[model samples]
Target chain A: MTNASAQAASPPWDDVSITVIRRDMLRFARMQLRDSGAAEDMVQEALMAAMTSAKSFAGRSAFKTWMFAILRNKIVDHIRASSREICGADLAGSSDMDAGLEEFDVLFNRRGLWNPDDRPATWADPEASFEQDAFWTVFDLCMNKLPEHIARVYTMRELLELDTAEICAELGITRSNCFVILHRARLGLRECLENRWFQGEAR
Target chain B: MKMMNCKDATQLMSERYERTLSLRELLSLKVHTAMCKGCSNYGQHLDVLRQASARLRAGNTSGEP
Candidate 1:
């Protein structure tokens, strides 16, 4: 809705060609799976499956959205299959990222007051950034940089919009533990965002 | 309620979203943040993160603008 972006358009999806779609799909899969080869294979698999179910293209969603849905399901299926094999390990040890605790520690001093250097600064016009693609790129990177277990809990609570009780049940964690994890997640994420994105602004 | 340190105050700030704080916890947090600009700004940053993630929940994977 910003005049600049409205006039310019974005993501350069104007091509909207299969090549473009495939590339975009691969990018998303790579981010989610964090494995280049695996992402490539999943996108290939999704493309093939989409061709077969082309008839199911009831025009309910955009082509990219439909394709993404297929790709996401494939990724989920892959995770489910793999996690089934490693189920015990995953349940027994979705450990808190110790580095996150260190990050939390640095935020305050021995006196339990904010460290002058690590103290939170007011972000400049943060809500205005929600509509910006470049901002999301920074956001995604900050998200991905989180330790896997932290990222997992954060994705469940924030992206999936799950309630804390539901998240605790799913993770087999106590309510208090879930609260701590969520708090640590917000702390780490906000710090990362500040360093990566807001730090660049002339404040 | 005992006074909350910045670390505990920030953690409580996060929990405030997931659950209602007891009156004591809420009052201590209120008293601390009322006097501490750093914790107050930290609370605002947490709100920004919440809003940003909500966009992802709305199905915008990339390129929100």
Candidate 2:
């Protein structure tokens, strides 16, 4: 049998387990970093880490979730290292306060909330006309408008699925400060999306 | 019953809406939302945003473009 055929003939999960998982990791990385290049790098590093530590996989959580946790850590580490120069400065000192005000607290406290079952009904279903492409376009635009640090933190915590404690540790932020940043990020995005897309809709 | 202010509602929205809040925060938000139209509406708005974001992510993953 051909190598490809042999692999295909195996169980589906066994045949493409790595690919499927890697894609998930990439998707998550993309969400967290919001930068394609950075997300790719983070995924590569995470996969390498996961493979090297395969023996440590105790099956405590689903493989995907465990892998995601590792990926999140890697992304956090990358963000911290790259932005080390600004670590000591006051977080609120920057002119990005407007952006910070909306996203800081909301994004910071967004852990343990990923399950579909947990989402509110109002958010459970989206409008039929809400194409993902258009939503992402607006989303990206709004994200791009954020100041770099605030955006980065929001991306890490919200998109990447890093827990607040992990983020605080990685970024050297206090819990209160993390919450503040997340709150600002969400508020800013809400306003941006409302004005840009949902203006006519009763808000 | 008093309406929850933007400050308090904003703080509780993500967690309460996501059902991730601690008992104290959850109860507080529940009590606040029970009487607060503004806060309840704000929570609904957050739900809209989350759904929108998820849809966007799903679309991206599916290669709809």
Best model number under DockQ: 1
State the lDDT of candidate 1 residue by residue for B1-65, as single tens digits.
45689999998999999888899898889899999998999989888887876555334545555
lDDT by residue (A1-203, candidate 2, tens digit) is 57775444332235377786777567666666668898788888887888778656655555666677788678666776865554555343444334446433442234422123222222223463254445556666777777667776777665655678876676667777777677666666765765565553434
Top lDDT hit: 1
RMSD of each: 6.6, 8.6
Candidate 2 docks at the CAPRI level of: acceptable
Backbone clashes for every candidate come to 0, 26
**What is the per-residue lDDT of model 1 for residues A106-133, given as tens digits with 9 covering 90 to 100?**
7778988888887888788976676667
Model 1 stretches astray by more than 4 angstroms: A1-33, A36-87, A94-100, B59-65
Model 2 C-alpha lDDT per residue in residues B1-65, reported as the tens digit of each score: 34444466666775443236777777777787777555565577676666655543332332334
DockQ of each candidate's interface versus the true one? Answer: 0.52, 0.25
Report how far residue A102 has shifted in candidate 2, in Å: 8.3
lDDT, candidate 2, at A50: 81
